[model samples]
Target chain A: MSEVFIFATLNGLVTGLLLFMLASGLTLIFSMMGVLNFAHASFYMLGAYFAYTISGVIGFWGGLLFAPLIVGAIGAIVERYGLRRVHASGHVAELVFTFGLAFLIEELVQFFWGRDTKNYQSPEIFDFALFSLFGQEFSAYRGFMIFIAIAIFAGLYVVLTRSRVGIIIQAAISHPNTVANLGHNVPFIFMCVFGTGTALAGIAGVIAGPVLTTFPGMATVLGSIVFIIVVIGGLGSLPGALIASLLVGLLQSYAIASDVGMPELLTLLGISFDRNHPLNDLWTLNLPQIAPVLPYLLLVLVLIFKPTGLMGNREE
Target chain B: MTMLKVSNLHAFYDKSHILQGVNFHVNAGEIVSLLGRNGVGRSTTVKTIMGEVEPKGSIEFKGEEIAGLKPFQIAHRGLGYVPENRDIFPTLTVRQNLILGLKGKEENGRWTIDDMFSMFPNLATRADVPGGVLSGGEQQMLCMCRTLMGDPELIMIDEPTEGLAPKVVEQIAVLLQEIASRGVSILLVEQKLSIALKISQRLYVMGHGKVVYEGTPSSLLEAHDVRAEWLEV
Candidate 1:
């Protein structure tokens, strides 16, 4: 039981960090541009598909290296031609533009890659188990994924806080007009930020593709969850996103791992529900059964109780 | 040398015409003030000249045509603007704010970070603090100092001392003189006629988006009717 709990925790950490990779970019873009890219997950899907195609030619390492670049370029073009044009129409228009973009990209992906899931596989080098605990083996690729996520997070923190470009970007986030008046090309900065953000999301898709399976529906499956993480962590906050990602990841992991639930609670309390009860589903629901809905449930709770999210700056 | 020349400039905020044929000039090493009431288009004049507002007519900076250019483009061409409502990056430290003011290639401007700190000791003490946490006077000082770091040939400062303690206003006056002494031309938009008369080499009293009075400080001081009709509340 303890071993199961321990493995679940480790898995949770992996999932949480993976979620952070996507959330960090979303938060960064939001802070800078004040617009949430609804199609962010579509870029991630493109990353995976791009990587799969590239890997067939030059192997996984080459695919990993080039896929994000391609995605980043595509993201920059989209910003320059699509979002920037819609921006003048106001926030709703921008949101609708991205929402439509996600649908368009999905159709494009299916047209190009087909509706079937790609046989995306982890690199042969990372296929072996790193260690065996309690007769269960953890793949080295999972370890690699965790390492990459941590490195990206650390790198992002340093780049935002310690570098010259970071300071300018940070200043631009709050005072764009003043930044322009100071002679910084504010629009150029916005374009770069948008590109970088999508690139980060692309990287997340590349690594998670093999583990989660690459398919047309992969983006739709993860899109709402990623959006939840950003909102739960506090929109436009890096640290908040980090905490919230791990929280959701671990909570879901533990829930899925545990067998305890409504039935167990009722049994402990010496109360029994009738088979004919209308709330039979609720009465019999276990932790594993509830795992899928945990994130949404938490999101609702957070919104009702703490609308700014755990670390969001109070809205003006 | 004439640092800036504006002739028959027309600007609008949507359908409402704000600056109607506004004209003004500032020479190198000279301090010129645009004095007017709240809605008399003094801010719009500077904003239009800074390329914040799209204006119709000619605006020459150092004899180069600058109308219809983007704000950053105008700024890159040696024009600095300190807006009426001081827009500081609230999250950034004072030092970082000043650093952002540094030009890309020519970083060694006329003013150093230390010079700004020494001139405004309040800023030096709060150098590490975020701009949002600073008092209004400190933010105004920071806004001015940050623009100075860009080393502009001519700066158009819009209401540098609007809502401030008397001492800070005096400090701003002294700083403006220091800026002029360093050979940087100034186009000041001010509401307080006393400060304008004391610091400005030439004054342009604006009413209804046009220059109602343009004269030397002494000449304007002697004209009671100009002050009574246009400047006085």
Candidate 2:
């Protein structure tokens, strides 16, 4: 039981950090453009498929390097030509534009790669288990993912806070007009930021594809969950996103691992329902069965109580 | 030499003509004020010059046509604008705000971060604090100093002393004088006639978006009828 708990925690940490990689970009783009891009996860899907193709020719390392570049360029083009045009139509139009974009990208992915799971695999070099705990082997790749996520977080922090371009970018996030008046090209900055954000999502796709299994619906599976993380953490708040991601990740993991459920509760409370009763489903409900909905459940509760989430500055 | 030449500048906000064929000019190293009441297109004129609004006339800066250019393009061409609302990047620290003002590394620029701090001691004390937390007066000072960091040849400042204590207003007046003495031209849009008369080398009273009165400060002061008809409440 203890080993299950430990491994669950480790796995939760890995998942949380991976989600952060995507959330960081999403939050930054949101704060700057004032638009919640619905196509962000589609960009992640593109990264995975692109890497899958490139990895076949140049191997995994080469795919990892080139795929994000390709994705970033595509992101820049979309922002320049597509998003910019829709911007004049207002926020709803922009949201619809991105939502349509996600569908279009998904269709394109299916057209090229087919509606099937790609046999994306972890590199052979890190196949061995890092350690054996309670007779269970912890694979080295999960540890590698944790490392990459932390490195990216650290790199993002340093670049945003300590560098010259970082200061300009930060200023642009809060005050694009003033930054423009200071002689920085505001449109170009917006393009770059949008591209950089998608590229971060691309990185996450490249890394997580093998573990999660590269498929057509992988984006749909994880995309809304990432949104839940951002909302739970706080909108447009980076630290908030990070905290929320880990909390959701760990909560789900622990809930899934634990066997306690409605059966245990019924037994403890001396309450039992007939199998044919209307409330039978409720009586038999289990934590593991509802683990997937934990984030959404929390989201609803948070919205009802504290609409701002944990650290969001902007009020709805 | 004329730093900015505006002739027959007309501006609009969705069919409501805000500036109706306004004309004005600022010369090198001189201080000029655009004095008018609220809604008289005083703010609209500067905004049009800054390319924040569409203008249907000539705006020649340093003898080059700049009427249709974008705001950043105009800014890059050595034109600075200090807006009435004082739009500072609230999340950034004072030092970061000043740093954003710089065009590039200060190789031979007149203003530096240190210079900004020394010019406004309040800024230096709150160098590490975010701009959002600053008092209204300090934010105004930050806005002016930030624009100055861009090292503009001609700065169009709108109402620098509109909402400040008497002491802060005095400091701002002194700063403006110091800015002019350094050979940087100023186009000040001010509501207070006393500040305008004291600081302006010349004055233009804008009425209904046209130059209703344009003269040296002494000439404008002597014209009591013009003062009552166009300026006095």
Candidate 3:
């Protein structure tokens, strides 16, 4: 039991950090632009697809290096020529634009990469196991993912808190007009932030593609979970996102690892419902069976108890 | 030489016509005040000149046309604005706020961070504290100092002493004088008649979105009819 708990924790940490890589970018963009990019996950899909194609030609290292840059350039162009135009129409328009962009991107991906899953694989260097614990071997790639996520988080935290450009970006987040009046090109800053954010999402996609499976629906699988993490963490709060990601990751990991469920709970409480009861499904439910809905359940709870989120200060 | 000249400038907020044919000019090393009651377009005039509001007429800065430029472009060309509400970045520390005010990476500006700290010791002690936690007066000082960090040739301040302790207002008045002494022209939008009368070399009374009265401070002191008609409640 202890071994199961230990391995679950390690796995949860890996999953949580990967989610942060995507959540941080989404939160950054939301805070800066005051609009959520509905197509953020599509950018992740593009990263995976792009990496698959690049890795096929030049190897995994080349794909890892260049896919994010390509996605970032695409993101910048979308902000400059796409979102910027819709911005004047209002917030609803911006949301719609991103929503449409997501569909367009999905269709485009299907057209380019086909509907089938690609044969993307982890690098041969990480194919070996990093260590053996409790009769199970943990792959080096999972450890690598955890390391990269930490490095990205540390780098992002430093740049935002300790650098001059980071200060300007922070100021712009709260007061774009004043920052512009102070002589910083705020629109350009917006473009760069959007680009960088999408690039971060792209990096997540590159790292996650092989493990999660590279397919047209890869984005759909992780996209809603990313939104849940952002909201539960508190919209536009970096630390909130980090904590929420870990919570969701651990909750799901533990749920899937353990066999505890309604049966055990009812037995412990000395209460049992008739097997023919209308709510038989509820009595028979198990933790792993509902692992997929745990994050959503947490989101609902957070929204009910703390509407502003864990760290979000904005009332609306 | 004219540091800023606005002639026949018209700005509309979705056809409300906030500023209509407003004309004004500030000279080098001089402090000019725009005085009027609320909704008289005193704030709109400065915002229009700063490119926050779209202008339909001529705005010449140092003899160069700057009518259609963006706010940042106008700022880069040596124009600074301190808005009425003191729109400080609340989450940023006072020092970070000042740092963001510096134009680009170079520290060649006439005013430095140390200059701001020395001028407002209250801000110096709370340099690491977030702007949101500062007192209203401290935030106002930080806003002004942030603009000063940009080192504009002409700075337009809108209602710098709106809500403050009398002591802080006096400090702001003294700082304005010190700023003007360094040859940075000022276009002040103010509500308090005494501060404007004391600090401004010339005053423009705005009414119905146009300059209704313009004269030296002493001359305006004697113009009771102008004050009663345009400035007085």
Candidate 4:
């Protein structure tokens, strides 16, 4: 039992930190632009596919460095030519534009990479076991993932709190027109921010591709989960995103690791149902079976109780 | 020399024409006030000149045509605006707000953060606090000081003393004089007749989107008919 708990925790930490990378970018873009980029996960998908192709030619390290930059440039171009034009038409137009962009990107990925999953693998340098716990080995690649996520978070916090550009971005988030009047090019700032955000997502994709599998359908699988993390964490709050990511990650990890089931609960409550009863499926349910639904359940609870989210202060 | 000039300026909010054929100018080292009652397009005139509102005429700043430019472009060319609402970034610290007002990375601006703190010690005490926590008067002072950080040749201030205490209003009046003494031109949009009359070298009385009368402060004091019709409540 203790062994299961330790391994679940380790796995949860890895998953939680990975989710934070994607959530941070989504929240930043939303706060700055007032529009949630529905195509954010699609950009993540692009990163993985780009890394897969680049790594095939120049090795994984080369792909790791170049893929995110390529994705960031594409993000900036999308903002400049696509999103900016629809911005004048208001929020609905922006939403539709991004939603359509997601579909367009998925199709583009399919056209370029095909439907089969690519055998993207972690670097050979981290192929060895870092440590053994309870006779089970833990790979160093997972440790590397955790390190990258923490570094990104620390770097982001310092830039926002202590740097000049960070202060400008915070000001632009609330009062864009006022920032522009103060002699800063706000539209240009928006483009850079959008690019940086997608690039962050690209980084997540490059790292997560090997662990989570890289395929055209990879985006569709993780896209909604990323959105749920942001909404559960609060729309545009960074700290909230980190907290919510860990909560969901741990919850799913524990559920999958544990063997607890509805049958045990029913027996403890002195309730019994026939094998062919209408609700027998509910009676026989186990924790792992419902792991995927746990985040959504948490989302509903958060929305009902704290509509502003855990740390969200802004009403809009 | 003319520091800022706007001739035959027209602006609209959707379909309604807010500024219709307005004309005004401020010479170097002059304190010019645009005075009128509410809804008389006094704020609209200044906003149009600052490029916050779209204008359909000529706006020449330091002999360069600036009409049809974006707000930041206009600001980069040395025109600063302190909006009527004092739109402070509420979440940012007062010092951070002042830093954002700096044009680029240049630190040799005529006004520094230290100068602002010394002028308004209340802001100095609350320099690290968020702008939202400050009182109405302090926000106004911070707003004006923020614009001054950009070191503009001409600053357009809209209703700086609109909702402040008498003592704070007096401080702002003194600050305006101090700013002008440093050779920065000012175009003040004001509702208070006495303050406008006392500080402004020249005054323009606006009515129905156009300048009804333009003259020196003393001449406007004697023009009781113009004041009663366009300015006085």
- Most accurate candidate by lDDT: 3
Given candidate 1, what's the lDDT at residue B27? 96
Query: Residue A55 in model 3: shift from native, Å?
Result: 1.4
Per-residue lDDT of B100 in model 4: 90
CAPRI accuracy category, model 1: medium
Please write out the lDDT profile of model 4 over residues B4-81, one tens digit for every residue.
Answer: 988999999999998889888999999999999999898888888878888999999999999999999999999999
Backbone clashes in candidate 1 total 0
DockQ of each: 0.73, 0.73, 0.91, 0.89
> Which residue segments of model 1 deviate by more than 4 Å?
A276-278
TM-score versus the correct structure, for each prediction:
0.98, 0.98, 0.98, 0.99
- The TM-score each candidate achieves on chain A is 0.98, 0.97, 0.98, 0.98
**lDDT, model 1, position A247:** 96
Evaluate model 3 with DockQ and give the value.
0.91
* Residues A178-234, model 1: lDDT tens digits: 889888899999999999999999999999999999999999988999999999999
* lDDT for residue A200 in candidate 3, whole number 0-100: 94
Give the number of the best model, judged by TM-score: 4
TM-score of chain A of 3: 0.98
Total clashing pairs for each candidate: 0, 0, 0, 0
lDDT tens digits, residues A60-84, model 2? 9988899889999999999999999
Compared with the true structure, the alpha-carbon lDDT of candidate 4 equals 0.92
lDDT per residue as tens, model 1, B114-181 = 99999989999999999989999899999999999998999999998898898888889999999999
Interface RMSD of 4: 0.7
Off by over 4 Å in 3: A276-281
lDDT of 1 at B130: 91
What order do you get sorting by lDDT, best first?
A: 3, 1, 4, 2
